[model samples]
Target: MTSADRSSDLSRAGRLRLAVAQLNPVLGDVTGNLELARRARAEAAGQGADLVLFSELFLSGYPPEDLVLKPAFVAACREALDTLAGETADGGPGVLVGLPWREGDKLHNAVALLDAGRVVGVRFKVDLPNYGEFDEKRVFQPGPLPGPLGFRGLRLGVPVCEDSWNDEVCECLAETGAEILLVPNGSPFHAGKPEVRLQVMVQRVVETDLPLVYCNQVGGQDELVFDGASFALQADRSLAFQMGEFCEEIAVSDWRRDGETWICESGPRVALPDTDSARWQACVLGFRDYVEKNRFPGVVLGLSGGIDSAVVAAMAVDALGAERVHCVMLPYRYTSDESLADAQGCVDALGLRYDIVSIAPAVEGFTECLGPLFAGTHAGVTEENLQSRARGTILMAISNKFGAMVATTGNKSEMSVGYATLYGDMNGGFNPIKDLYKTQVYRLAAWRNANRPEALKGPDGIVIPENIITKVPTAELRENQTDQDSLPEYDVLDDILECLVENEMSVGEIEARGHDRELIHRIEHLLYIAEYKRRQSAPGVKITRKNFGRDRRYPITNRFRDRS
Candidate 1:
């Protein structure tokens, strides 16, 4: 018989069951995350799984960043892994767990295979992704190319997260007499990443001629949200199982002898959400996890009755429930009756705790205090900034008193072009819409009104009123201070921002899109000059491929503009 037949014969039994553990691991919580692993292993055993696989760096959590530099943190992870390994001494299902492994001078992103209460094998990630939201190469030293590990009677080819992104790792395993491939991942979600990941695996299956299983983590880590849409593909490239996205789940798959290779007999298949629903789910999950993980009792935000604030309030209600969400209407002299009514309508619809706090006293106090310094200067943008500062101060005070986190509400458009006040409206613990463009804010607002997913905690149907959607967007800090007074209309502005921020197009190229040359130049200047402001903005969910913080990094002091 050939190697394929020999590989097949190594399986002690005719049947093998595999379990995918899609779990959320708290960063640097070695003890807690170890318990999570133990629980997942127990659940997999309950499902009659012979093997349980977890996502990458599950013990230390994904992208531990600078924490890996601390020797104590790395030692804690190893100690916890040893504890978990010792527990496997019971005849339960084996575990393939990912963690940071320190071998002498080199630290590796590795996964340990445990059975019969001890680690049987360990595999390290060969590929370290360094582009776009990933800085693995900066933290982890890549391991040598790997071959398959023997488990029970099967030769299992296991590649850690980024290793399977390319063809080399999978090809090496296939050539070295591996019968199957299983990949553990901490892949975060972008708009179209799920579909892209499936195609990448399809190519792997085609090249290796072996079945493959993918297990990804779920929940938010900082601004990155990992949607656990784990799946498996048979040798023929047929989907065997698909776990749901954005939730924790333990799904199992059965494999049967198909000639010299094993093929998955099939498992659960959850339909993936559409792009809009997926984006909505990502934002909610990210927002919820950030609040819960950081130990915030609840959240508070100033509800100006604009689309951005309205959308954030709804998200807050969905994420933490209406009881935890506090909406304060910080109205000034320019605050329209329509706006006040709209804000109240939102509070009533979402069942939120509502309060109307006039900023008249606070603004007047500031004006009086600064009157001497501003005696000769005309009343302009500086005074307009006072209104926002007053609102921010009030909301922050409320947060402090109630032990709630302040949730700022600023969309990508405002954030990209310095349309926000630094210590004023931009003052919050987090912003749910920080990465969402103005048009996307409008789009998701309408989408939320139309459909409420089962996953969200908030109530359904028209949570955002029609008037909020139809109203002209404004800051309401001054009389008739619509956003367009200083910027282009939202549709035009959003397109230009996307081109510059996401696409990184030049002004000439943006102008080629039929925009005026001067306008493109002006928007570019705004985008560049606003870097300092963005540096100080609150963290938010990253829905787009390139978000403001981790993905896009520009020099704040650079004078170079896109002259081309």
Candidate 2:
């Protein structure tokens, strides 16, 4: 067919079947991801889908990181895209898959439209996001304002992920004769991010008078979890469809042309869970994918009677089955009877294997060896850290023996203030609650007890005892030691940290929020000093806007205190 003939055919559309594939692709797994796209295309063809839409970077996986810099990796991705394009010769559904494309000296985050055994057209992502968890500018060259790609009888405006966040890309497409807007995203979940996304899409819909289909990637990747709550908005700014969150799905939507605009017919609209439930599910999915994708046998964590460890243990069981999770109590001299009872209670409730390993033997050995060297030095934080080191050593030994990943159980509150012991409690493969504040941890534990998600592999009921959640949190390093002895109360500390970390509020701004200036300064100092510890900490689920790893970056040796 000639170009003019194809353009005329695209203008007259009756019913178009679009299969939105919300899939999870492993980072740097180009060939494997291509196979995933192939399978989804086959399934969509079986359902008579005219087109299959995969999430951003479905071929090379989202955020390929420095791997995209390697020429061989980019070549592999290009090869994979070509192979998938060849499969369209069978008259199957045309595929729109995201991959890294190289032209001249610049590499672009490009989406390819495949049909009839060839790449029909390609649209580069214009908006290269550089803020928050994105560093797209480091590797990817931004494409110019993109117009729509012509697919079989349709002028489809394809916005790659961040392109649809603002008005420019969609507006440019609408002016270029685009009929429908199909946005593919790799948007990671951070608390109420879905609501933020919906608002952004509605604005574009209202601006362009074009129906928008938002498709996001699903599953977890390292610290990032892509909640695939993909949806569609009609030209009238009404929601047409809503997909489920935190799971992989392929939903088919039927679109019809009405005069000069396209409208999505009514389809499935799955209600999203509340904030607490969503956060819990994000942690579960993130942890599960890390364990399974890394091919670990299971996970082992030091389960103290504290709320942090207890909640982590429950999440591990939910992510991996009970049989795959192992909990151990590394008790020291300060370990309380209440703690032992509570730890055992959690293990029993979750139906996971539990063991108690006393750290006294190792703790005493270390103290005795250092006694003479220390001379008359007083036993203080140094001595207290010995217990934590002993417990970390024991957990590592267990992990080495059984090939299970060790899960560190420090919440964001402790991490923010440098309260956690590095190479001690921080020695683990991953942390499920590393991004959550101590206060949020309590709320999630309570929510999990009251409601069990169908995706959970663990048993229902109160796995976390009320005592664990209700009791005062302690490290049990010394006699009757509480966290507040060294840090502020969790409620206050978390709020202050959130201001400093997430909001980037100045000392004056935070103080104006009813916080004492001195307290803010102290927390800010600790937060900066703790950068080194957070740098070494295991990657965890990112449940907040500013996680320690990617979202917030600070130097450890910096002396700049937020005195102002």
lDDT of 1: 0.91
Relative to the true structure, candidate 1 reaches a TM of 0.97
Q: Rate the local accuracy (lDDT) of all candidates.
A: 0.91, 0.91
TM-score of each: 0.97, 0.97
Tens-digit lDDT track of model 2 for 1-564: 654454354356567888999999998888789888988998888888889999998888888888899999999999999999998877768889999999999999999999888898998999999998999999999998987888877889999889999889999999998988999999999999999999999999999999999999998999999999999999999999999998788899888888877778756789998999899999999999999889999999999998999999999999999999999988877889999999999998999898888888899999999989998898899999988999999999999999999999999999999999988999999999999999999999999999987888878999999999998889998998998899888899999999999999999999998999999999999999889999999999999998998998888799998776
Number of clashing residue pairs in every model?
A: 4, 1
Model 1 residue pairs with clashes: 10-153, 11-153, 88-117, 89-117
**Model 2 spans with C-alpha error above 4 angstroms:** 1-13
Candidate 1 regions with alpha-carbon error over 4 angstroms: 1-10
Per-residue error at 100 for model 1, in Å? 0.6
